[model samples]
Target: HACVIQLPFNQKVRNNPDFFLRVIAENASCCYSMLKAKNPGFTLGNRGASGMFPSEAAEWLCYHAFTVKLSNHKVVYKCLLKPLKFCHWGCFKTGALAVLCHMVTVLANL
Candidate 1:
């Protein structure tokens, strides 16, 4: 009995973390197209200029935690979904992200 099924995006993004991020990017009202491509950097706000490819983004999110990189390679959908904010973009009015980023920054300085 499998507890969860994991499927990844290739050519199209749908019904996953990438889908949610896409919807938020191409929201009918806004249509800012925030996610340009899946690269290796932040994919939101002005910093998203160097957007991440979906695959890379998922890997980065899953591996990069508390500024430490994990050795796991095979990532499941649920893992990526847990950390993403479905409708939220960047740190805009998002105190939690701001705090988290601040914490990481402070820790890096130590």
Candidate 2:
């Protein structure tokens, strides 16, 4: 089973980051419960930009630990630095590079 959650713009830009994390965790838990009831052996996979982030990663880890009882699940963590084709836009290149650099720094520290 797969699902894409579209959070509201206001919620995404909320002052309290924990609020958005809580929303994601609550929704993910509900989905996991439903899917687990239907099939005990089902594997849960997370994709897209959110999958690579720390908050979502924590939520997925917790879900896997409590529900699936397994720590190994495939998560696609794509680099966000791809160029846009239609408009020839390189606008977000700097931001994407920054995020990639920051991720490398964090990983190196760990």
Top of the candidates by TM-score: 2
Residues 1-110 of candidate 2 have per-residue lDDT tens digits of 12112445633212443443354457655664565466656443333223233233333434333333211211311111111111112212323334435667998999
Worst 10 residues of 1 by lDDT: 65-74
| Tens-digit lDDT track of model 1 for 4-66 | 233334422223456544443334223233344343355443332232223233223332331
Best by lDDT: 2
Candidate 1 Cα deviation (angstroms), residue 3: 1.7
User: Which pairs clash in model 1?
Assistant: 38-52, 38-53, 39-52, 39-53
Q: How many residue pairs clash in each candidate?
A: 4, 0
Which residue ranges in model 2 land beyond 4 Å of their true spot?
A: 1-12, 40-110
Clashes of 2: 0
Error of 1 at 49 (Å): 28
Alpha-carbon TM-score of each model against the true structure = 0.24, 0.27
